[model samples]
Target chain A: MGYHHIHRYRIAFVDCDPAQIVHFSNYFRWFDTASREFFTACGVPSWRDTERGSGLIGTPLVDAQASFRNPATYGEDIEIESWVDRWSGKSFVMRHVARRGDTVLAEGREVRVFAVRDSVDPPVIRAVAVPAGIRAMCGD
Target chain B: MGYHHIHRYRIAFVDCDPAQIVHFSNYFRWFDTASREFFTACGVPSWRDTERGSGLIGTPLVDAQASFRNPATYGEDIEIESWVDRWSGKSFVMRHVARRGDTVLAEGREVRVFAVRDSVDPPVIRAVAVPAGIRAMCGD
Candidate 1:
């Protein structure tokens, strides 16, 4: 019941492994899917359709990691609860929790930054401040 | 090296996120990376070039879940060694280990089955026996 952020999802058949449990990799993809949808629902343009493909801004993951608490399998429906807790100039924190009913499947956090499109190398990642509009919506 | 039926990979910076730790989701990507290399080395055709445009012989997960015993971070390398120990017709065992030079970051095993593409209400993930070639190589 928190306005912070929330995303719901179902485990697809392709999401599992030979062990009949969700592969660890799929969780990251799910996290990205839910988080992106949450942002889109909040009025942020789709990263894929941003700036008419001008690519002026993109949120590429400079770093990512996760810890597995339990297993998820095909046919399981789960919910992801998310929040934007702290923000620095260029970076912000995204926390996520995966659950089935009341059972906690996994907990994770991601630190991301705003990157500008560059012609060469990768976009420079900096520690700049969060945009004012985003801050107002995310509620610092 | 003996056809020991296992490959080990050490997690590294390139494999982690800004949390200065491993994201639970990155594990599946790495698992795919390691498994692909291992199978190709064992003589399985490239996943894409197969005549089936990726044949019906698909390694799909039936279940997957993990537990974190330790944290892995930037510049640290951990081993991800995998093996196929159990095979009964269409299903097999793939175990992966994330470790430092000697310390284990995480250890997990997945249960997988080879299923055909089914177009139905809910795709029936029927288990087929492990192909002879794969069994010979992995059932060491």
Candidate 2:
């Protein structure tokens, strides 16, 4: 378990689909944002800062999944609670639960890896091992 | 299995993140669009038409998942091949494969249900059975 963080967001009109409910894809975007917020809360620096210092661009997702339990409409406020559920040598799993009031709207899981720009002409990215100091900051 | 459809898209500048690669979340959106395209290719009427006739809103996701295999960048053209992988009484699974030329970028699976607006104050949606006509049209 890692430090938990809650990210609050208002469902904008643009976030809703023609069906008048939040599109399922938006949850993944919110979960990704919440994951970054969790890292920031744990004293992890910005990717820009890390890139400057360690050549680490940012954590990128390798796999993602979400279960939608309830429908949410525009103008509703929602909260996503996020934390690192597991850490491996090269990747970590992030868990996020999105709620409106007392009802859980959705739950998301993402597998992400720290990455850097590979030395290729066409520009490629490669995953790197999870950094120990950053892991320590996020609570090993 | 159902009729397969390929949806093509060009990656936009706004689709990329600071990592200079397409954000993982965008893949889900593309997969979703491809699902709809698959239905359209099967001669299924639009949701608006269905709602007018059957009170059916649209297919809403119950579960969604994606695996990222390669990173893509802006200005690249990609194609998403989508089809129904499975169908049950109340829900169906959609599969999507995204590719850039010979490279497979990602694969996605979504479980979705046909739904209608429930008679609730704040607006609730409920899943309904898979319509036989739609299933036939989709080559179930």
Candidate 3:
């Protein structure tokens, strides 16, 4: 288990839909932000920096899933707790839990891969093995 | 099978990450929009209208997943083909394929349920069975 990182933000009007609740997709966006925050907390450089040094473009998600547990509206402050739950050779699973106080609003899990830009024209990305330094930094 | 609804849009700069590719989360957002477009093309009323008439708030996602096949950048015009892939008693799976020309950019699937506001304060939502009329209108 790696260290947990927390990212907090208030819901905005644009994050809600006609149903007057935060759009479910917004949770995935917040989760992505939280994943980056987690990497930052682990002392990993920004994707841009890594890209220049090692051709590591970014960690791109291969799969993401979320279960909505409660409805939250704009003006509500929420926080996402994120951490790397599992790590494989070429991919890892990042887990996120969104909450407002004690209520769990949603739970999400993302399987992501460290990718590099393989082709410039028409842009293509290819997954690479989990970098050893990154794994150590993340306490895996 | 329901009629496929096509939603086309140009990717904006804001939709990309530091890698200059559309962030993976944005695919979920577009799939969501495509889900509603599918309903509109099937002649289903807006969520607001359904809410007033039958206590239906909107279809809320319970699960969402996407597989990236290619990377796309800002200013690229892409279209998503969306349809209801499966309808169950209380939920349905919406599927989407995003493409530019014949190149597939991504594939997404979402499990969603028709929900109604079951409580006022602190807002709670509950899923309802698939509406027969709506299913028929969707050609499911």
The native-contact fractions of the candidates, in order shown, are 0.14, 0.80, 0.69
State the DockQ of every prediction: 0.10, 0.84, 0.67
Worst 10 residues of 3 chain B by lDDT: B117-126
Listed per model in order, the count of residue pairs whose N, CA or C atoms clash below 3 Å is 43, 0, 0
The deviation in Å at residue B55 for candidate 3 is 2.4
Whole-model Cα lDDT of every candidate shown, in order: 0.61, 0.92, 0.90
Worst 10 residues of 2 chain B by lDDT: B116-125
The runs of at least 3 residues in candidate 2 whose Cα sits more than 4 Å from the true structure, single-residue gaps closed, are none
lDDT tens digits, residues B7-120, model 3? 998999999877778988899989988888889888999988999999998889888888888789998999999988999999999999999889899999898999999887
Error of 1 at B16 (Å): 18
Query: Per DockQ, what order, best first?
Result: 2, 3, 1
Candidate 3 scores a C-alpha RMSD against the true structure in Å of 1.8
Per-candidate Cα RMSD to the true structure, in Å, reads 10.3, 1.2, 1.8
Expressed as tens digits, the lDDT of each residue in B16-100 for candidate 1 is: 5433356656666766666666676777775444426534445665544444455556555556777665666666667676667
> lDDT, candidate 1, residue A113?
65
lDDT of 3 at B73: 94
What are the runs in model 3 whose C-alpha is more than 4 Å off? none
> How would the candidate models be sorted by TM-score, starting from the highest?
2, 3, 1
**Candidate 2 lDDT by residue in tens digits, A13-73:** 9998888889988999999999899989999899999988998988999999999999998
